[model samples]
Target: MFKSVDLKLQLVELLISSYANVDLSKVKIIGVQHILETTHSMFRSLYLLGLKPENIAIIGKCYSTCKEVFEEMLDDGIYVDPSSSSYCSHKSYDEWFSLNIENFLTSQIDDLLSGKYEKILVLDDGGKCIKALNKFSINTNLIVAIEQTTSGYEDIRYGCFNFPIINVARSATKLNIESPMIAQAASERLYLSLQRKGLKTNKVLIIGKGAIGNAMKNKFASNMEVVCYDRNQKTYDQAKVELSEIINQFPLILGCTGKISIPFDLHSKISPGTVLASVSS
Candidate 1:
């Protein structure tokens, strides 16, 4: 079902070649949770690259769409499922908890204290691991970090950290090349959802004019009357006004903004049967 399996393999090979001389067993990995099979394959490749099974930790997301498959694929590493208790608890670690907190930090600190790893590598999404680190004092060496989402980068951009973080979220390869495909896939899915409900609309309102929003606007322009509005575009365009004025004008509303594009007060202004979809995290 994953279309990017080949590309994921290429990434694995690139990582393997890049760290060919380094001892992977001495490196501690902290990564984000993802549902795609391609993400699972990437973790599996890392295990095969001689990184200690226990050294690799997969932090759980706020919600899991593929927990069973993830656990089955990466059985050796520390599996931090928010729904369960801590797997590898430490006496010194605090008892903080949340829906996505599965004691990931505790286990990693325990391993570090036991002299299991000399360096830490963070592969994060939405800045989950970075936020977790801010909660406690980590005395280990953090070498390098990679964040692959714009929201995640924004979260850590102003914050102080010991390591150099790479922002793959705003990279040319992701924004210029991959975003349009993502928008296309999202549009196709939205189309299918509308078809299943037998809903038809002549007008669509897009809430953000960023990469995904702009691509989505183009995608729907040929099929329906599309209107795109962004906070940044209000300065020059007359049509780019507050959402409340045009909230009921369109039968379909799509939120391309990663944050809350629509507030609670505006929800009452929307048409009764209008479909709302968000293509962003």
Candidate 2:
């Protein structure tokens, strides 16, 4: 029974607390189709913060689901692509439309420089749209970008977008649609299923000391006997485990190392019931 104001406050709290001590006035939100709903929530939150609807703009592909969600909201101040007929139908009012990333970039930049917005908030890496936006001369004083996957991080770094990017790690794209509570319930169900099947603490082995590997290690540590293996000598030393010893000891493995293949004969070392879960990017 979350009220709109409660949801808005939660989003504002997340956005503000995420950057800690940063100004959030006049920010433009950018994302792809999948992030549309989340962006809508953000829009409501920003509006509740006393910002006008005209100050915010969205740049992404127009999809039926997105259209349905946007249409349901009374404040249709979002700027969409003109070629997208679904968005075009509502173009007469507060709607803005563009055909491609190039056009969207041009228009958004103009709006930003025209003393309309002060900050820019990138919700998710909008495919190549982020890269395209990077080529333009943006006028905002501060830029905030969010990343959910390793691929998005690479995109922000390599795209040469001059902005302070924040990586908000999320589950797989499909699982992101479910609320965090629901996803946790689903994970608990899976864990119960495994336990009921007499699975003896699936010896979950993670390979890599990077952020993703560390996250996986933390997640599976409570349910399974977890071991981490990294090629980096220093990291292995820090973890107090040797790769060779791990390779020789366990057959259940998750390869988080960036390497294409495990260094040793992984198949021949483990037992028949050993399970491998790869979390490598």
Candidate 3:
């Protein structure tokens, strides 16, 4: 038996609309995720909708650090078992997990199709898992995917996605607050830490000028010198020297672009100590 809990209204509406004709009693969500509050909240929202804790399997490193939350999910009846969870985002946290990403997703899909569940909700943050699911879920009963990151959304937009995709990255409200604020907060912490290390923090070169990128630029401009580069030819044309010269001279380089924006031709020219910090990742 599950306890009565309040569901976030926005998530309630989204889930209601998405599951319109489906029986909520038979739904399961396999969240291939990251360690974030939104992820935790999503679990809560789904549980409140009557999804059994045993039907939702979270596959990621989120289970590594957040022991309390993980225990709460289990205690509350969220579908989590030691043999089924895989939790590694980067090799840096090598002690915590070694990501067997392929094997993990394949196992999840196998279980998803083993007749214990009716529908599956995939929260593929990196977009790679959805691509994996696309191959296996071709003849499945029901599987819905939601791409949570801009990079993942781009992959879907470019036709990597075969199943129905709910691009949460495109939501203006989430775009306006969650991403930008996270980027800002991350950059702030990066700057402070570098400054503490006695590194020069006065001048920062930020690549890309999107919402989060622009927010970082503006936040830094009040107290430091900020330079920008956009890969768009038109934008690049406006500041050719800025991208070429500033990269070589600046001791700190901030990557606002999720993908590499540093031209391969210019890579060797950058100063050896120049730090390449990605606020997005």
Candidate 4:
């Protein structure tokens, strides 16, 4: 237990050191829900960098589980949308993401009683946080906004907002390691579901030759005969079967491309009991 906490502290140290040369003493940030493991470290690191406890406000209840969301020691100061004992009474996740959270946060931010913040942070994979901040009326000189989700990064990349966005979601290390592993896990979940349905088979069709697609191919190849596809000529040349011909032949089809690269025209050819999984956005 101590070892894990110690590792978290070390990561905090590294994060703090990244800004050691900068004059961040005057920066005031309001962090919303963040990944569970890093939230404590992030909160402590910001305070050590010279921000006051009151200057940092946190939102959201948990990460992957309810236990991770409702915590007694998670906050030292301002807390919004906290997962208290009555958390079950709060709006459902869909309702919160759609309007409740945006309304609540926007109301708090428009009023100075919540403390003026220069930045807002979020990781819920919902656009409401950004939408709320976009409508903020606080007196502080709000500069840039930061995000911690792949879908949020999609919004930034597509020019959804006018402000500068720092997408910590696709940090170089994460794109190279964390994301591929997560994609692999998705593939595993798909395989397990297929197994539960008594649909295990040796032949599989994997689309995309990118990191995630390739990872899925490798992870699935050991148990199944795998055929990979991509729009690129190089990838197509290496695959043993034509994309059009394999759709009807394979019992399982997975699209690993980051976008919708799978052809809808071929959907009609799929076997009746086909199992389809995708990691596309």
TM-score of each: 0.81, 0.48, 0.73, 0.59
In terms of lDDT, the best-performing candidate is 1
Model 1, span 149-229: residue lDDT tens: 876787778988766788988999888887898989999999999999999998898888888888898899999998887
User: Candidate 2 or 3, higher TM-score?
Assistant: 3
Model 1 clashing residue pairs (backbone): none
Model 1 lDDT, full chain set: 0.70
The model with the greater lDDT, 1 or 3, is: 1
Per-residue lDDT of 230 in model 1: 83
Clashes of 3: 4
Per residue, candidate 2 scores C-alpha lDDT tens digits across 1-281 of 23332445464568755666554455666544342455566666665455555655554444433555555333556655443333556443113322355666676676656665566766654334555566677753556666655545554555555766665544453224333443254346646766697765556666776555665666677867777666665345366654555565554566655343364354565567765555432
As a TM-score, model 2 comes out at 0.48
148-203 per-residue lDDT for model 4 (tens digits): 65655655466556556667767886568866677777877887888798877888
Better of 1 and 4 by TM-score: 1
Task: Please provide the root mean square deviation of candidate 1 (C-alpha atoms, Å).
Answer: 5.5
Per-candidate clash tally: 0, 3, 4, 2
Q: Weakest 10 consecutive residues, lDDT, candidate 2?
A: 90-99
Error of 1 at 250 (Å): 2.0
Task: Supply candidate 4's per-residue lDDT for 222.
Answer: 82
